[model samples]
Target: MLVTTPHQDHSATDLPRTGPATEPAAELALLRGDFEVHLTVGAEAADALAAWAEEHGVKFVHILLARGSAASQPMLTLRASGSYTEVLAETRRTARRLAADGFTVLRAKVESVPWAEGVPASDADAARFGAARYFEHHVKLLVPEGAATDGLAELAVRHAAHLSRNARRVRPDGVREQFVTQRCRLVGSETAAARLDALLADLTAAGHQVASAEREFVALDSDETLDAGWIDEVAAVAKVAAVSTAA
Candidate 1:
């Protein structure tokens, strides 16, 4: 990704929007095996994200809430096999497709959950690769030479529990497997969002380049009641970030 230069202002298409025009989300992924993928492009891309999830069995909070953009082409059929080998191949294909789709590709990778090299020896062994949905909440920046470590450290410490799916999967009837934390992102509350925004603005004033700093509300895919859990998680996300920044 181009770090030194400021990110382009990704203009939204005529598609319905869930938030401010300045904030738009685009996503593409395959949720099978260890081939999980999640990414957000321009706000215009949310059009595709919304339509594709409903068409396929995808789980996404942003798409469910989004309303403005027009109809968009779906990227991939979500009806993929759970086999590790099959999904791995599909994930590679998915990444290639994304690269050719005009979006900038950064560190495209396919990894095994338990860190195995070759295919599993038995059906049971392969199950350890457990299916998961991939997503991340990040604030990319180009700080001073020495500041990179601190920035990365802060991200490592705080962004893990910040955002959740950027994903919307259509599950089969009556399937109720609880969605665990594959990972998380963004400030949770308006106050935290404003504070983080202020910090980024201050960084700009001090000559630091912020490539992207987005705020994501709390999200989870589960059958249980989680209203309180959501609030606590969001608050925890905000607190960790603030503490990390202060340190």
Candidate 2:
């Protein structure tokens, strides 16, 4: 089951106070309690590392590598799967193992961006793809490069929720299954309503076949479900709620 606990912001305590001039050879840090591990690797090596991590029961959380016109060896990021708390525990175990495997832990900054908009689609395939909900949480992470937007994976992780959906239908291999869904909290009566309104506006503008909408939710085109990239676009409009106006 997905672990549910308040994500403690221990980045200051969890991360190093300073960094070197250049990025470290390899490092891992927990962002908002979720383990975000970064390491440099070549393009081919990156693919291999992903497979290896998965084979060892490590779920891919998010990844960010160097960007350029030409493809070359790049850094590999390993993340723990599940809620912030769940991932945190797994990360601790995985971090030690990764260190033994020649990886070092570095200070990373994590920021939890509030998600104010989310739209569910009506298509059955979208449901299967788990495009039913959107989630947001407080973020915390270490920025080695000082807040430069480097890669899509980094941006995606920093500003989005870990959407969970069912994999392709398959016969059970005598293993029990648990499906998890991620959700975001709306701060107040008016703010929640405003956010939902913005969500519906974006979906309709993006040519999504909107099915319905409400004060805090909406239904959109799910048949040709847009990936997380599209959802990111929708969420981009959601601004952080003002502290004084929060419920």
lDDT of each: 0.33, 0.31
Give the C-alpha miss distance for residue 85 in model 1, angstroms.
5.4
Reference-based TM-score, model 1: 0.25
Q: How far does residue 153 in candidate 2 sit from its true spot (Å)?
A: 16
Candidate 1 stretches greater than 4 Å from native: 1-35, 61-85, 95-247
TM-scores vs. true structure, each candidate: 0.25, 0.30
Top candidate (TM-score): 2
Cα lDDT of model 1 by residue, 1-247, tens digit? 1011233222322111332221211211222233333333344455564564454455323321111131121223232334433443344444344445554322222322322233333334323322221222234444333232443333333333211222344335433211112132221233334445545554556555556654322111111121123213455467756987999
Per-candidate count of clashing residue pairs (backbone under 3 Å): 22, 15
In angstroms, give how far residue 54 of model 2 lies from its true place.
Answer: 2.7
Candidate 1, residue 83: how far the Cα is off, in Å: 6.5
